[model samples]
Target: MVKKKIQVLFEDEHYIAATKPSDLLVHPFKARSQDRRSLLRSLKKQTDLYLFPIHRLDKPVSGVVLFAKSKEATRLMKEQWNSENVSKHYIAMVKGVTETEGVYDFPIKTDKGLQEAKTSFKTLTSNDEYSLVDIEIFTGRQHQIRKHFSRRMHNLVGDTKYGHSSINNIFRKDYKFYRIFLHSYQLRFIHPFTKEEVIISSPVTEDCIHIANDLFQFDLTNIGNEAKEN
Candidate 1:
């Protein structure tokens, strides 16, 4: 059911973490579409109170998304994220075989300021052609993983901006996967209201898992596979 598919991994008096669907925009940008349902609108239907975002994941990316219930909670959550009190983790399906484990030591900046981003990754499964990766981010930056990991060599599978047409076509045409191969697999942070630490994780969407299983031999029942379905 769509009810179970749209799940809230974490929720409290002040905040909530909803595992987002792939290809859904976190917020509206550039041109608006008839099919577009702004994130705020969706959250509003969940509740009438004001909602705010602690951090934003890209439109094509899927997984744990945080929202604030009030102005005070919003500010507190933002502070926690900026202070590195929150830990971010993700899963990626890349173009080629990768190492068993490695760190993506890259730096990124935004208009307001700059921050050092550390992306740690490891190969979970491989078919000698493609690979499944578990990646973690020590700092938050826009497109940090998508850009740094995609430097020149074979890019992230289905990454149209940083990948080759041939590889993207493998997922698009062959597998009918249009969304990028990225998932916000986990989030760890202190609750704004209770001050208790929470570590929430999410499962990859069905389509993504099927693609990995079919092309890369990645089984859907990996260690973190039981996380809520996207």
Candidate 2:
């Protein structure tokens, strides 16, 4: 198979931020024995440098992912992440309309047990059938956004794990949309080396825009720019 190009959004002496395509793993896993192609490995081949993953996106979710260039940079970035100093923002197209703004302050179950997870969301636009939401995650528990939104009965579009199978099938058949409708739109943090504030963002994929327009008549032309500013 031909390799998909990893889209680099930002790069510097200490860090790199890149857009990860859906269905791609951030790192190789023993559990996923057959799936060895990962973003880290691909980046290593491309840059020919050892890279450290600072954060991860779900295999089926596409968007910005951060990596550190060195062990020290990784340590510093991980410290910021653990302290909740890193700001993560995402855009999700969901099954139903939501309030103008709301927060899902709930605990999610993990292998270690239940952990506190908080996600805030603002409705950007909506029709009767679907809503485009801007989400800010306060906690990084696994599948936090997907689980929280599923609890609210607004499972993300094309999310088979937490969403309606029929809806996913419909999109797949009609629009050829197969990936979850969640994009890691923005990441903001203080640079570990420069000690300066940095913000990085990724544009919504063209497929997502086409699906939104075709299915809901929603325009996402300025969403990326607006998301970066806010």
Candidate 3:
């Protein structure tokens, strides 16, 4: 396996959090014997220790992701996650204007077949061609946010598979970007073993900022409707 860079966000005796780069799989694949790079293997090799995944971010989604260093920590983390004790937040640039805050409660099915689920969203920023959306998922389904928005009138900027042709054509169709516009910015949950509240966050990725700047000439200001417009 060839070596690659790993971005560690927060690390401790019990667990580790990382800003996962786009297009990297959390774990290795049995389907492909030739693909040698995987996040799990990279961390283990670098730390000489095992880590457990408490939750998964999609291959295209980039930013803060958590991993447990010990079995007990892993178990407890998973418990907190399953109990709806965690608050996960993501920001994305989707096509079209979202005038007010809204929720998307639609059923999402699996790609292999049909075991669909539901999710919701709230718009934080509005622009003529794009909006900065703050998203939340009630149910953990594969590509829930991506697929849901893709099926809508507007599509997330860099999404290829579920995105509409006209919207996606504004960007590249064949290439999977270095990162998608979606970013896992905030995570809040009770400490798995400590029984205390913990909140972790990552600043919105630069790629999104650049895209917004190129199109809207925006900084963080216009994300809120009340905030000054760019």
TM-score of 1: 0.86
lDDT of 2 by residue, 16-58 (tens): 8788988789998558469988998998898888999988898
lDDT of each: 0.75, 0.85, 0.70
TM-score of 3: 0.81
- Candidate 3's C-alpha runs over 4 A off are 1-5, 111-118, 173-178, 220-230
Winning candidate number (TM-score) = 2
2 against 3, candidate with superior TM-score: 2
Candidate 3 minimal-lDDT segment of 10 residues: 221-230
Ranking by TM-score: 2, 1, 3
lDDT of 3 by residue, 1-230 (tens): 76456766667678777767776777765576566766777777787888888777777787678889888898878766745787677888888886466666766678566545555677766767888778866666678778778777657777777665666665554332444688887676777667666666666666666666666666743332221101
lDDT string for model 1 (51-70, tens) is: 78777887788888988888
Candidate 2 TM-score, C-alpha based: 0.93
